[model samples]
Target: MQDVRAGLISAFHWRSDPPVWPEHRIYYADDSAWWREPTILGELGSSLAALFSDEPPTVVMSPESRGSLLGPLVATHLGIGFAEVRKGAERASDDEVWLRRRTPPDYRDRHLEMAVRRSVLRTGDRVLFVDDWAATGAQAMACQQLAGDAGASWVGAAVIVDGLENSADRRLLMLRSLLHLRDLRRR
Candidate 1:
């Protein structure tokens, strides 16, 4: 875990400009470096393992940014299937629901999508929502709504980091932060 953390701090130069804010700092970069850190990858995998080992067995996520990179890794770690919420248009007509995410001010005007493509949740399937980070939590709320609409049992939420100071929302059963902003503060 330390090695992964080291790689991410170096790769993203988190040491220089650690994304620490009085509130949430949802990463400053939107490039590959944000998702390429070894520590982040490992921490993501561990987060998945920790969450999936609990009651439920399935997971879903909203895609297009950090979640796009995170969803697959969590799915692979949990040995279960993963689905991405699509952005822009309605690609499917039936058997799926659509939700709009109001991202941070910086990500305003950007649309994010999350969907279940192959099979809808059956009678006893458990669903977990995973995202890269939590800032204002608009994205996470969108994901929770999607899970509810799908009729899947909502387990909880797991994140690479929880930038929000007050995280008392009920939807999150188990919340985990891989490497916090303080862990990467500028020296």
Candidate 2:
């Protein structure tokens, strides 16, 4: 765990410039370094999965972006299956049914609709949401709603960097993270 934490911190990079970010300087993260490191890659799954060792989920679910990367690792560590949560219900027809929910405004204040296939998340399955980061937890809220719709119990979320601005969201998501956003902030 110590090695993983050190590896994660050393691998992280943030970018902020006057020309690019004048007043509102949001974190421009470059997290590709750790992805290439063999040791970090090997430890990520086990470290993140250890966060919820006691109450392990039946299935791990994550959004299709970066979450897809970490979710599988946690699932593999826990010896459980992983479900990919898709963003948006782009194609709607009589073909397949999806459990969907519109998220509240995120860090960028953009509302997005996240979805998961009904078949992937079965009824009565315990779901653990794993992701790379959580800024506003809008996506986590949507995930919780989708889990409810599927009749699956939500076991909470595990993330690498938790930057949540609201204490309510922190509690609501039951967020556990390896590093707080403040740990990486410019000091």
Candidate 3:
């Protein structure tokens, strides 16, 4: 885990040249380098799962792309199941019911619809959201709402980067990360 944190910091960068960010945001972080390293990749799942080992989730969930990658790793480490959440979904099938919600403005200020199959979350399921980065709690909140809609309890979020600016949002999401955004800068 320590090595993973060091690897993440060494790999991270804050960029402002045509950065992909909202109007009010200053710089965007580039963390793709960390994922390319074998050592970091090897330790990611177990390290992330250890963040909530005291009260491990019954199942883990992640949004479309990145989350789908990390969520399964954590679930595998903890011997739990994983569910991949869909984005901008209506209904996958006539027989299957999906719980979907429109997210609040995200870091990029884009409003997206997040969805998950209704059957994926059973009543009393302890759900934890897993992702590579979390600049805004919008997606996590949307997923949490889906969990509640299905009578599952939330167990907070686990991530590699904690870029959230709002303290209230952090508390509300119960977010934990391997490194904070400020730590990426040269010390």
Pairs of residues at least 3 apart in sequence or in different chains that clash in candidate 1: 4-39, 85-113, 85-114, 85-115, 86-113
48-157: candidate 1 lDDT, tens digit per residue:
55655655566655456667777777778777767676545364567554544433332354445544443544434576667766665656666666666666776767
Best by TM-score: 2
Give the per-residue lDDT of model 2 (tens digit) for 128-185.
9999999889898899999999999999899999989888889989889988887775
Off by over 4 Å in 2: 18-26, 91-93
Model 3 lDDT per residue over 1-187, tens place: 7888888788777776653656754666677876798888888999888888877699998999889888888999888999789998766568988888889999889999998987777889999899988888899989989889989998999998898999999999889999887788843
The Cα local distance difference test for each model comes to 0.58, 0.88, 0.86
Question: Model 1 has how many clashing residue pairs?
Answer: 5
Q: Candidate 2: global Cα-lDDT?
A: 0.88
Off by over 4 Å in 1: 14-31, 37-43, 92-123, 170-174
Q: What TM value does model 1 have?
A: 0.68
Better of 2 and 3 by lDDT: 2
TM-score of 2: 0.92
**Candidate 3, residue 33: how far the Cα is off, in Å:** 1.5
Against the hidden true structure, what lDDT does model 1 obtain? 0.58
**Candidate with better lDDT, 1 vs 3:** 3
